[model samples]
Target: MTTVQSARGPLDTADLGRVLMHEHVFVLTPDSQRQWSDEWDEEEQVANAIVKLNELAAQGISTIADPTVDGLGRDVARIARIQAEVDLNIIVATGVYTYCDVPNFFAFRGPGIIPGLDDPMVDFFVRDLEEGVRGTAVRAAFLKCAIDHHGLTPGVERVLRAEAAAHLRTGAPIMVHTHPGTQTGLEVMRVLGEEGVAFERVILAHSGDSTDAEHLGSLAEAGFLLGMDRFGIDATLDFESRVAIVVELCRRGFSGQMVLAQDAACYIDWIDPMFKGALPNWNYLHVLGDVVPALLERGVTESQVDEMLVGNPRRYFGG
Candidate 1:
């Protein structure tokens, strides 16, 4: 079995104080430096992340969980550096991302004609969790997976199976990325249930995109953590719409089952080119500092914010 440890040493979740459940420190596209164009560089990326972390710490955020899975260029060593520099608890994740984003090898030949919960790949996840990620002293505290917007693709389904097996072997919580406004969360929960995984050990990401109260309420009632992150992506839906879904969920007494984040990163060219004239817009901390406080002003209670930002994440990450 894979036994995971916190990267920031031992932590008391009760004193986790305030936390940001999902955010990325450094994110790189597949083509490496070439993919980033003129605005991307390692040093600049790290510096921007540090500034954001400091800003979040000042705003009462004591911990952060960066769910940058394997295909996402999750740099645990750099994360460790940021943690030490900022003195904020940062938790890193280990596991494969969505099949589309993963390398061709993972999607093609492997165990069970897909990335099954068997053999070498399973060994890979187990080793990373038991030892450390990429030979760094840092370790992963959670496992991350993703389901496509339309539901589980063949590649995605295989990844899910691998995740399930990893969960059974490691006892690490699984965080799943689902499509916005889709019923993918339910499908993910169904698969996990079939694999004999407990709902409490899984977090349904992007649950906020779906405003279906009954669906979200059902997931909460089923004992799963609902992640309503993606706070800064205004292109798809505005913050108010997303906050409304969360507020409605809170009203339905599902506050304790929710986790919040602004899944923003410092990929300069990835965002709309018009913003900052192609410079990296790693200003998610600004959103947390502004939007979350706005939610408070609009009657989202401090206790509710605490549940979404702090308490729920501690429980979800099994801190």
Candidate 2:
């Protein structure tokens, strides 16, 4: 009976037979859709999300982490409804995302950037965890934050600090959206370590995008969970290359800290209607049936797959 304890309660690892750590449920907003260049009606958007979730459920994926933050339409009520309908364990997030432009609310109140895990903001996150997400029945099981490619801006640093504060309060774990080949993941670990937060409680997301095996090895050695979540986005690099990186990392004796997911969202087309280019396949079964089998053919073992897909995620999300 493989099980990992989450802040919500104990989660059966068997229930999460195969899981995707980085994904979104329903994030439709004018600003978010600007990348797509067209407006979407709320009903259509919700229906699209339902279609995707149903697809995932049919493919044998038992759990998904929808890492959308507060302002990005992190609709907990809607997500809970979908979870009940689809019968999938949907873990949501509570934190803020980092962008070059700070929101007006943050700008008006600040001479300095607010730390993500700071006093009032930390209180807000803790309150959401204690009460309910967005005043709905769903509760956030993880804290999501981001670091830009160029190192932490003062604004991002504030958010990272706030994330750390939330970890201190709830011990729910933190997930970072990092730029590939950047040291921002390392920097996040450094800050969290300084704050007395255990490295095991932080997930360095998108670390696989970088071919720098040494950098990833170092983070894994430091005890942070490494997220190789973007599996099938092949325009920049093919699936083989991504699996090669994971295989290489395992060869270097760092399999213990690795996790895998496709990170494909159906809304990519909505976000960028101009992105008519080939998109990675979002079907979870394709990954489990095809991608994993291909990796196995390339000499990657079932154990390594288990480490990346099951063990590391179970540990990071506390199952």
**Number of the predicted model whose TM-score against the real structure is largest:** 1
Candidate 1 matches the true fold with a TM-score of 0.88
Q: Model 2 Cα displacement at 130 (Å)?
A: 2.1
How far does residue 155 in candidate 1 sit from its true spot (Å)?
1.0
Clashes of each: 0, 9
For model 2, the superposed segments whose C-alpha errors exceed 4 Å read 1-14, 31-38, 110-118, 280-286
Which runs in model 1 stand beyond 4 Å of their true positions? 1-4, 30-32, 99-102, 107-109, 112-119, 275-282, 286-288
Worst window of 10 by summed lDDT in candidate 1: 277-286
Error of 2 at 5 (Å): 9.6
TM-score of each: 0.88, 0.87
Please, what are the lDDT tens digits per residue for candidate 1 over residues 1-319?
A: 2222556765666666677777887666546558546656678777877787787788777787888877786677877777777857787888888645345765445654543335455667777776788857877878888886657776677778777888789887888988746778878878898999999888888787777889889988999888887776655667678778887888889889988877766553445456744322235574466667777777789898877877677676565
Residue 205 lDDT, candidate 2, scale 0-100 = 85
Clashing pairs in 2: 36-271, 115-158, 116-158, 116-159, 116-162, 117-161, 117-162, 117-163, 118-162
